[model samples]
Target: MLGPVRIAITFAMSLMTTLASAQEVGSQKTFPARDSLAALDDPSPDAADCLRGFAWQNAAFDVQLESDDATLRSVRFPSPLDTGNPINDRVTMKWYVAKDKDGNVLHRPAVLVAHESGSGMTVGRLVAKTLSLYGVHAFLIHLPHYGDRRDRSIKPENQDVVTTMRQAVVDVRRGRDAIAVLPDVDTSYIGLQGTSLGGFVAALAGSLDGGFDKVYITLAGGDFHSLLVNGTNEAAKMRQKLADAGYSGDKLKQLVQQVEPLRIAHRLTPEQTWMFTGSEDKVVPFANAMALAKAAKISAEHHVIVPANHYSAILYFPTIIDLIVRESLPADVIPAALKSDS
Candidate 1:
């Protein structure tokens, strides 16, 4: 019933709307905080109690703890990246504790949250604090050379990304075991979530530990080598440039394959995963996400926030907090409708 000109205008508007929506969803990673955990000179005493079962790996940090009915504490342990390199020094951890609605300590499950070195501790703290609000205990971990070892050195300018990734997985396993023994915490409900490099770490860790209850990953890819080979980010491109200049492809490929999420997918439960990604992410492409998803052998629900970019995607902290708090609640008590939505 509309004239040709009017119809044409309407179609144009629709196209523009769709394009705008896609653009928004493609670029959202806004979590902002640098060296959050590093900002603290001393770990909280309560946090130390949370690490009761953990064994000290070094004076800089410790691991292995059994959860108790009392107050929670913060604790740390050595990460695989602690190669004594001052440029990339860091201590991984299991910190934070979940509580009940009555303010009494609840034996809720614990989770380990990881972030890229560049992102610093802000992302990890945000996740931990938010999870605490949701009655879930979480450890804000230091990746490679961020917290605890911010002054550590960097050995390989072009580090073995895959080996580095596997090391992270190893640390996560140790952290998980240390936390699982806690008294008030539910070991069966253990889970993980991360941002950027940490997100990739979470996916890989989930693949490595089938006992992991659930996963909420953001800005991560399933395939390690694919991300390195086809990535458009400054880091990835830089790695490629280094390779073009002199690095060996065989070594790169070997390392990447060892940590590639695609290769580890068989270890995860498809029903317990959630992946969030930006369509406009320059560091991690949508294709890599898709590839990882396909390789996961699970149909994960993808939360698309239209018009969000990489840096801003994590900025929606309140939303993430809500999801974690709600999802981390006692699984049996969750309403069917809310469960379906999550």
Candidate 2:
């Protein structure tokens, strides 16, 4: 028969293992139907200042608003990435101004949302609507070579990866600057969110520049090309197919690095960011995401959706996503002014 001490030790070890697995599984799974925001680090003054400038320049002045719904009537300003690329031909951006119940502009926190190319913008639109319902203002942007501008004009070749990354950052900065100048927008309180490629871009933005109080990313990874190369043996083979399609490995790496979120994750503070990933996601696998979180040394919530696949992860966790946006990002700070001039 086992001694009492041995039995107790065995039980403890089993319990610990179970608990660790539970945490991992729980983190991978989505939150309940009632969504909420996760706690984030306090905003630095310098970061807030920078965010304000970004909002003032990008949100307030650059957009041509058509209706109260905040849809784009026309684009008065040019894209920083606009190099006559056919891809940029159909892209558009507009201001999202928050308001109080009385129709006055509410001095609330603002967000600049970056989305994966194309139908992903539709997801951004939903996020904007949800955020607005919660009193937070959000601006949805159409990324390069995606959405309406996805014509032959802005092919992958036309998009200079370095320039694309830099320009996208500038676009966010300008949006933050525009928000800062708006009488109704709270300059000090700012957050950012993105999905897939947008998540990668958001991570780069958060790491390169300070000012964003909170950042919530989904399906983010370390190195873009590396994620492609090492996700699986099958993926590695597929990458070769791309090479066969005429992509040079070195050139691809350079392009992917220009926007690698993991390469820049070290630049962020624990208080400012949180990353999430689906365990079964194949396009951007769970292991690659773990490598990113581990490299950054941040306690990310790695939720696994059990047997769920990549395309299903988004659909399966909308409620959790709503909670993530509400709770993951920092709360907007109240500004001195009570109302916006507009």
Candidate 3:
């Protein structure tokens, strides 16, 4: 027979383990669906001040769709960043097809969604489903060794943080072209979106050549090295992961610096790039967001501030998705005032 105090302690420990598993499983599985978005309002002109200016060539790759652990169809494509292993070189993306009121699929503007660091792709899937339901097609891309990209055949599919970041940028940039060529996709315009960890990668990717017509970044900010060193929650976990992998102190600083967005952010088309950040995000402090905004030279209206924290930003998705559609869709799709003026 156990005393009441011992029973209480045991219960508390069990609860803590359950919570930790829940937090970690996001990368392992997609959660069940959430409430649908309200009927979309007429496409309205938004505060975006930039225009797509370049015509860069999209990369070429072989692609195929196959069944996966998720609810939607899973697609695999050759990533531009290769590690010599055929299974390891391919990237994974979840296809969330858009449909009209009658349930018929629609060809529309597409957004390649980069997920947060959870590896569960919770935020990515949420945003993708919402966008698809709201009319646009969204692809939830898994960064290297994430989701279906993992293969048991390859003993350790994981790359170092720096290598992973570089590969993520390569995969994302190549994904724009890959998504464009898919059937039922309207190639007239394509958008790039990233949240948190994904946002940092997207920032540098869009900077490389401006291949994407529209860029949307959420819950991420600049000075990545400092963020990793001092940031709480996700950042802290990342630091621990790196330390466990033999990256500590100045070595960790050196690794994160290679992927810092500030170095290449100036290349982003400020007018066409929009940043959505949470005001109370402790993981990515407000000052860091401002640092990125400054580096990218993003216009005032393009930098949107949400009245929530990093974890709580999900609560504001209805409002955020509306803005994303207005910001990323083609001219005929939304006819924004900025597009009209240009």
Candidate 4:
């Protein structure tokens, strides 16, 4: 029923809308490739200063612990990034304990779990529960601006990305110290495991010191600039925000280089490191995962490739958890529950 002129105008408006949508989705065309970020792997003068600023002279701290169940305890500590910001200056943990055949508590190997970005606290708890079933005590630490640590003044999305990462590194390292001092944990067999965002933070934290006997990183990779610029989902959102703030090209690279895990990845021994990545991951990109693996000197066998994409990588959690248990715990110490019936 519309006239020719009205029909033409309507079509033009639709065409413009389609073009705008395409532009938003294709904005990453100008971003750098994974190989171009090699400079991020090299050590810089600022690396030592960053490490020192986050280091704690002592592992001992005031811990308020409460029992949630026979096998789990809730713990709280003063945040390593404490700046008198009550909301951001405290850390919470869910500690899963190992037990003997008689239900008595036992001193056992421990792993510090770093959670993913969103809904990570729930995932962290699942990982802790699974690790406990394998006889390894697990400590899941909530990262800055996550779970109980969330603050209105510095929401995770609003804070400087590099600063949040640095704070995470400090927090994860301190978590290792906290677990090591626990009465029923074996200090000599401490390990680290992180999923996605947590995995990236764990990579940097593990590199800072040889505190952990093993490091298991899942669904995570390196080259911060490349991932932010070309990645999908949450990564895409981050890119748009940075671009709006006038951070692109070399300037954006410089900002992310401050917390690039590749810079200190060399400190991680290949023998003690393992990585799990999805082959179809667009959020993290396959090349980004390989970069982290190569920097850590991990062997091809140690690098696990899942058939699914980023979100679907959860399908392999059982297999991934089993692998981590086998690598992290002593042969004689693995619990019967984790043993294969075959």
Candidates sorted by TM-score, descending order?
A: 4, 3, 1, 2
Q: After best superposition, candidate 1 residue 340: deviation in angstroms?
A: 18
Per-residue lDDT of model 1, residues 247-284, tens digit only = 54776666455456666555557777777777777678
Q: Per-residue lDDT for 115-160 in model 3, tens only?
A: 9888567777777766775568889898877777766665432466
How should the candidates be ordered by lDDT, best one leading? 4, 3, 1, 2
lDDT of 4: 0.73
Q: Which ten residues in a row have the lowest lDDT in candidate 2?
A: 21-30
Clashes of each: 55, 40, 4, 0
lDDT of 2 at 184: 52
Per-residue lDDT value at 12 in model 2: 38
Off by over 4 Å in 3: 1-60, 66-71, 152-158, 330-342
Best by TM-score: 4
Per lDDT, the best of the predicted structures is: 4
> Which residue pairs does candidate 4 place in steric collision?
none
The positional error of residue 250 in candidate 3, measured at the CA in angstroms, is 3.1
Which of the two candidates, 3 or 4, achieves a greater TM-score against the reference? 4
lDDT of each prediction vs. the true structure?
0.57, 0.53, 0.70, 0.73
| Per-residue alpha-carbon lDDT of candidate 2 for residues 1-342, written as tens digits (9 for 90 to 100) | 112233234333433432121111111111111101112222554434333322222222343333423221122234534456645633354445556656666667777777754444655655554455345677776776655555653346444555665567555544454445444566677778776667777776676556577776666667668777766543565466556656657877765554556655665666567776777877778777776776566673433233454456555334433444344334342211211210
The total number of steric clashes, by the backbone 3 Å criterion, in model 2 comes to 40
